[model samples]
Target chain A: MNMEVAHTREEDKDLLKVAGEIDAYTAPELREALVPLTEKEGNLVVVDLENVDYIDSTGLGIFIGALKSAHNYNGDLKIIGLNERVHRLFSITGLDEVIDIGEEREEAK
Target chain B: MGDAYLRLQEQYRKILNQYLENKNEQGLYHAQQFSKKVLENQISPEEVVSLHLSTLEESFPDIPKGAQDSFEFLLEVMIGYGLAYQEHQSLKDRQRELESEIDVAANMQQTFLPSGIPEPEDLDVGVLSVPASKMSGDYYHFVHDENDCLGVAIADIIGKGVPAALCMSMIKYAMDSLPEQRLQPADLLANLNRVVEQNVASNMFITMMYGSYDVRAHTFQYAGAGHEPGFYYSAEADEFEELSAKGIVLGIKRHAEFREYQRVVAPGDFIVLLSDGVTECRTEQGFIEREEITRLIRNHMHLSAQEMVNHVFHELEKLQGFQLRDDFTLMILRREV
Candidate 1:
C-alpha cells in the first residue's frame, strides 16, 4: 500500500503525520517530507507515527537521516505517537535511545 | 543361455539405475558393455563387478546432472553394484546463471538512483520513485549549487531491465559534466539530447522533465523533453494548469530543439511533475483520467509539497490496488513563498 503523509501546524511547528507501510518502495516520501523541514526556520519538527502500520529497515534509515539533518542545523527532529509495532521495532533496534521517540506528540514538545 | 541373458538384462537395468542415481556416466557406459558381454555368455556377474571396480579409478568421467552416479553404483552392487547417467547439461548451466543475472540487473537499476537528495532552499522538491521490476529505466536526482538553487530531474528510458538501466547511467554522468550548460532548461535538454542520440542504441529513447528552481525568486523554470505534461495548480484559480513543451524525446532526432516552460509558483501554489507511469496507471475500471489526478491535487492542494505528493502516491495505490505495470515517479514542488 502507498503511504500517506499529513501534517498539522501547532504553535508554529510542523507536526508531520505519516501512515501506511514504509518499505524501501515508499520510504522516499518520508525523506522528501523531512528534507523541506530543514529549509523552514522552525526550532522543532515533530514526526507523528501513530498510524504507520508497518516499517522496514529502510524506513528506520530515513528516520536516522532526518535526525542527522536536524542535528546538523542545531534544530531538533523528534518522533512522537509510535504505534505498538513501530515502538517494538525502535526498541529492538535500540533506536529509542538514539532518537527522541516519545509516547505522545504533546510529550515530545 | 536364455536364463543367463535374462539375468544379464536385469543386471544391466540395475547398473543403469545406479549410474543415473549417482550421476556416473563413464561407469554407466562400462557397465553397459560388461552387461552385453554377460548376455553373450562371455562374462559372469562377478566378472562384471570386478571389471568395473578395478577400472573405476580410470573409467569415471564428468557427470553433468549427477543422475548417472546411482546407475554406476547399482551396476557394481549387482555384479554386485550399479552405475548412473545424467540428463541435459545445458539446463543446469542456465539454472546457475538465472540467479546471478537477477543480482546484476538489480545492481544496475540501483545505479540510476541518487545516493541522497542535494540540499537546497526555496524549492521544496520531493521525488517518489518505484521500479516495476528488478530493473527499470526510471531515474531521478537533485543537483544544487552553492547558491541553493536546485536542479531536479526525473526521466524514464523507453524500455525495461538491463538495456534501459545502462542508458540511464550514461545520461546521469553526462548531466553531471554539463553544469555550465544547465543555466537554461532548454540548453540542458539540447546538450543531453545530443549526447544521448550519439551514445545510446537507435531503439532507445528517454522522456525527461527537468526543472531548475530559483530559490531566491520562488520560480521554477523547466523543460519537458517529450515527457508527460506536468501540472501547475494555481491556488488562486483552484485549477490545474498544464505546462507542456513541444519537443521530441531524447535520442529521436539529433538536433530536435527543446523549449523551456516557466511559471511562478507563489506561496501555496504547487507544480506536480511526473513520469507517464502515473497517467498510464490502470485502475480496475480503466486508466485514471488526467483530470482526476488534477482533482486530487485540488483536494489536497493545501498540504505541504511533500505531503501532497505522498497523498497522490497513496491515491494511485488505492486506485490500482498497489500494482503498477510501469515505473511510478512523482515530484511535487510547493512554493513556501
Candidate 2:
C-alpha cells in the first residue's frame, strides 16, 4: 500500500508522521521528506511510525542515514509512537539499541 | 489501418521489394534493419508475416487456386504462432535477466563442505548446505586457528541476490578477522554486528550463530544473534537441550550484545546447528515442528556425522515432495573419543 509521510514542527523537535507500508517503492518518498529535516541545524527529529503497517529495510535505512546526518550536525533523532509490529522490527533488527524508540504507542491494533 | 500501422506497412513493403528485386547481401541487410525497426516500434511479428504474404501475393497473381488457399491458411496459422513466438522471446529475455541475477548471487556465495571444515581428533563434523533455488541466502564459514580452535559461524541473510552475498561476505570477513585472538563468542558477535550495521547498505539483516570448540578444554563456547537455536545432545543422559544464547539480528544497530553459552562436550555427545529451513520444513500437512526435527536427529544418531546430516536432508526433501521452499543447511559437531 502507498504510504504518507507528513512533517510538522513540534517546538524544538521536527515530527515526521508516516502511515501505510514503507517498502522499497515508497522509501524514497519518506527519505525525501525526512532527510532534509535531519540536516537542519539543531534539528531534533522524531518519527512516528504508529500507523505504518510494514517497513522494509530500505525504509529503516533512510532512518539510519537521517540519524547519522543529525548526529553529524550535532543534532539528535528519535522515533516514537510505533505500533507493536513496527516495534518488533526495531527490536529484531536491533535498531532499538541505537535509536531512541519510545514505548508510548499512540495507536494499537 | 492507423497511421502508424500504414507507415510500418509501407516501410516493410519497401524493404521486402528491394530485397526481392536484388536478392543480394545489401537487400538482406535492409531486411535486417527493417526487422530491428519493427521490434523497436513494438510491432508484432504476425503483422510482419501478414504484410509479407499480402505484398508477395500481389506479385504472384496467376498462382494456382489450391496453392493460394494453402498460403492463406498458412498465413492465418502464422499470425498466431508468430505473435506467440515474439512474446515467448520477450519473456525469455526477461527470464534470462532474472537468472543472471541469481547467477551473480550463486557466484558470490561460499558454503563450506565437510572437507573444508576443521575437525579436531575428538570432534566429528558434518556440514551440508543446499539452496532451493540457484542462489542460497544461508551461508556458513569456519575458522581454524593456531590454538587448535575450531571457530564456526552460520548466518542466513533475510534477502537473497547480490546484496545477500555481500552481507555474507561482510560476516565472513568479520569472522575471519577473529580466531587469532581466540575471542569469546559474545565479543565476536558484537564485532560482527558493528560491521553489518556500518558497512551493510541496510537492505538486509542477518541471523547468525558464532562459536568455537576448544579441543584442549573440551568446551564449546557460542553465541547467537536471533538465529535458530542449536541443539546439544547429552550422550550420558540421552536428552536434547536447546542452546539458550540469544540476541537480535545484525545490521539494524551499530552495537549489539550477545550473551555467550558454554557447554562441555563429552564422548559420543553431539551438537546440532541448522538454519530455519530444516526446522520449518513444510509438507502437504504443513510445517513440521521443532520436536519433529529433534526426533529426526535422534533417529539418525547412530549414523556418522556426515551421513546423519545427509539422511535428515533427504528425509525432509522427500517429505516436501522433492521440492524445497527454502535453503537447507545443517551441521553436526559430534565428539568421538
Candidate 3:
C-alpha cells in the first residue's frame, strides 16, 4: 500500500492517509509510517483508511502494532475515513472496540 | 603390430574382468584410466573386433554364427550410456519447477499472519494460527480501542487452499465494515452473517466467533456462529465451562441470527477461543476430546501465555503422532486487574 502523512503544527494531531491494498504485502509500509509518529508525538495520530481499497490480517496487524506503539507512549491512535469495505473488516474482527475507529477521521480522534 | 595388439587385447581383458569384479567402483577407476591411456590409442575398432573374435574363436571354435555376433551387439549397448545422462537432466528440471511453485505459495501464506500480538490494557492475549499446507484455511484478528474495549475473532473457512483463502478475504471485508452496535454481540454477528452470505460462494461457509470486552466493566460479551464451544476458564471457580453460542455458519444462509453469550471477566478469569481445527484435530489414533484438552491446559496453566499455547500445540502434535492434518488456531485471553 502507498502511504502519505500530513502532520499539522497543532502539536497533538498527526494525520496519515494510506492508499492501495493493505494486505500482508503492503502492511509494513503503513506500519513503518505509523509506529514512528506514535513515538515522536504520541497518539493524536489519526489514520485515514478511506483510500485503502483492500486489507487483510497483515494490515490488521499493522493497526495493532501502531495502536500498541501509541499506547506504550501514553497516547492513543485512532482510525478514520474507513470506507464501507474497511469498516466491515474492523466490525467483523470486532476491532472497532479495540481501536477507536469512525466514519470520519475527526470523529475517530 | 601383432605383438602390441596382443598386449593391448590382454590389457583390455584384464581391465574388463577387474571392472566386473568391482561393478564400476574401484575397478572402473583403474579400467577407465587404462582405457583412456592405452586402449583408445593402440586399439582401432576393427583391430579390437579381430582381437575379440580371435580370442572367442580360440575359446569356442565350434560355436554357431549367431553366437559370433556379440561384437556388434556390444557397440549398440555402449550408446545407451549417453541416453541415460539426458534422462536424468529431464527429471531434475521437473523437480526444480515444483519446488519454486511451493516457495511462492508459502510466501503468500506468510503474509496472512499478524507480525505480533497487539498491546492492550489489563489483559494478556496471545494467538497461535498455523497451517499444515502452503496455504491455510484459518484466520484471526484482534482490535483494541481507546476505551479499553477489545474485539477478538478466530475464523476457519470451510475447504482448503486458494478457494478458502479467497473466501477468507471476503469474510474479513464483511467483518471490517460492521458498525458499532452498542455492545450487542448478537447483532454484531447477525450483521456479519448478512455480509458473508451475500459474497461467498454457495459451497463456502465460515465458523467464527466475535467478542467484545470492556475493561472498565470487566465484562466480555461474545457470540458464536457455527463454531465449536471454546472454554472460559474461571480461576475463581476452579473449573472450566463451555462458552457456547451456536448458530448457522455465515454464508450458508441469509438472516441467520447468531446467539450471544456474555460473562463478566473477573481478575483471574479468561476465555479460550478456537477454530474447529483445534477440536477436530485428527491423528492416526483418533480425534481429541474436550476432556483431554482440559487436562493438558490444567497441566500447563502456570506457564506463560505463549508457552501455554505451545504446550497445547505439542499435545495436538502428540495426538497426530507428530503430523498435523489441518490448520490450528487458538486464542487465550486472561484478564488482570
In order, the first chain's TM-score in every candidate is 0.86, 0.92, 0.82
Off by over 4 Å in 2: A1-109, B1-44, B47-105, B111-115
- The DockQ-based CAPRI class assigned to model 2 is incorrect
Candidate 1, CAPRI quality class derived from DockQ: incorrect
Clash count per candidate: 48, 0, 16
State each model's TM-score restricted to chain B: 0.70, 0.75, 0.74
User: After superposing candidate 1, which stretches have Cα over 4 Å from the reference?
Assistant: A1-109, B1-96
For model 3, what is the alpha-carbon lDDT of residue A106? 38
Which consecutive 10 residues in model 2 chain B have the weakest lDDT in total?
B106-115
User: What is the alpha-carbon lDDT for the whole of candidate 2?
Assistant: 0.79
**Residue A62 shift from truth in candidate 3, angstroms:** 37
lDDT of 1 by residue, B1-337 (tens): 7677566656655665567578777766867686567645655444555444434433455543343555556555665222111123345658779968888878856766877654455556666887777677788878777665678888877655666678788988988888663468888889899999888754356778888888787778888776777788787776687767656667756786777877777776777888867776778785677898888767776676667778888898888888876778888877765
The order by descending TM-score is 2, 3, 1
CA RMSD of all predictions:
22.5, 9.7, 19.6
TM-score of 1: 0.54
Q: What lDDT does candidate 1 reach at residue A56?
A: 55
Better of 1 and 3 by TM-score: 3
Of the candidates shown, which would achieve the greatest lDDT relative to the real structure? 2
Docking class of 3: incorrect
